[model samples]
Target: MEGLSELALDHVAQYFSALSEPSRLRILNYLREGERNVGELAEACECSQANVSRHLSTLAKHGMVVREGRGTAVYYRIADESIYALCDLVCGNVAKRLEAQASLLGSLAPKKKR
Candidate 1:
């Protein structure tokens, strides 16, 4: 049981590590729209082709995304829609927290000087 738990924890660590990169998050966000080829994804994410490919490779290895080749271009899409749902949940939680903080700050702000 301990071994199994350790394995599960390791898998979770890997998933979180893959998500720790801003570029990777951007790529995931772009993929949320639809499947896109490497070049198009690079353009959308504002990264180089090689950089995007590297990030995609990492995501592919972790089974978070999948690549499909057509003619000369290779396209990528989320491996499972469940990943998108998780991302949405996390982003929504963060947004709510930020909004609450903003409201608190607004309430604390003093009136403008005369």
Candidate 2:
């Protein structure tokens, strides 16, 4: 982010926005297993093909995933494997925060009777 131009920062925000949706996150997670077509993604994500396609378009626009055509099917894979590292980092931080909150709440709970 440092030394990045305003336009570049805007693009960064757009990329993050593409990742802000749960459906998109699920799609990425599924793709991590390997490339998958819309039907496979829809089935795994438990959504319609059209919905998965829309999310794919958003992810592709952000350059997060790449699509390849094969016969009547199109498959998508992660463009940058580094995304997993980023997701892992954020997930670890979130888990730590959640654990801390749970501990705080537990401390405030009423004592159990012997």
Candidate 3:
């Protein structure tokens, strides 16, 4: 039973490891806006089409995003809105922490000369 639980945790860890990349995180953030074709996503992320496609594939495999084919174009969007909400929550937390750190630093800094 313990071995089975450990194996499940390892799989979950791998999923998070894939998301730890900056490029991938950017791709996910862009998708939160709306469904977009590969070219648009590439432009928004400032990455090559091929690179965006590869990251999208990884995200799709992990069920974080979904790909749809419209005629000849393939578009991607967040697989689950809940995931977007979770990402928003995380972003909010980071912003709050940064704001608090800045306030602390400001308090510790010497006053500027008049």
Best by TM-score: 2
**Candidate 3 lDDT, 40-73, residue by residue in tens:** 9899989999999999999898888988999999
Off by over 4 Å in 3: 1-4
lDDT of 3 at 96: 100
Tell me, by lDDT, which candidate is best: 2
2 or 3, which is superior by TM-score? Answer: 2
Weakest 10 consecutive residues, lDDT, candidate 1? 1-10
Each candidate's root-mean-square deviation in Å?
Answer: 2.2, 0.9, 2.6
Evaluate candidate 2 by giving its C-alpha RMSD to the native, one decimal: 0.9
Q: How many pairs of residues collide in each model?
A: 0, 0, 0
Candidate lDDT scores, in order, read: 0.92, 0.95, 0.87
- Measured with C-alpha atoms, the lDDT of residue 111 in candidate 2 is 95
Estimate the overall C-alpha local distance difference test score of candidate 1: 0.92
- Candidate 2: list runs displaced more than 4 Å: none
Q: What lDDT tens digits, residue by residue, belong to model 1 across residues 77-102?
A: 99988987888899899999999999
Q: How many backbone clashes can be found in candidate 3? A: 0
**Relative to the unseen true structure, what is the C-alpha lDDT of residue 56 in candidate 1, on a scale of 0 to 100?**
98
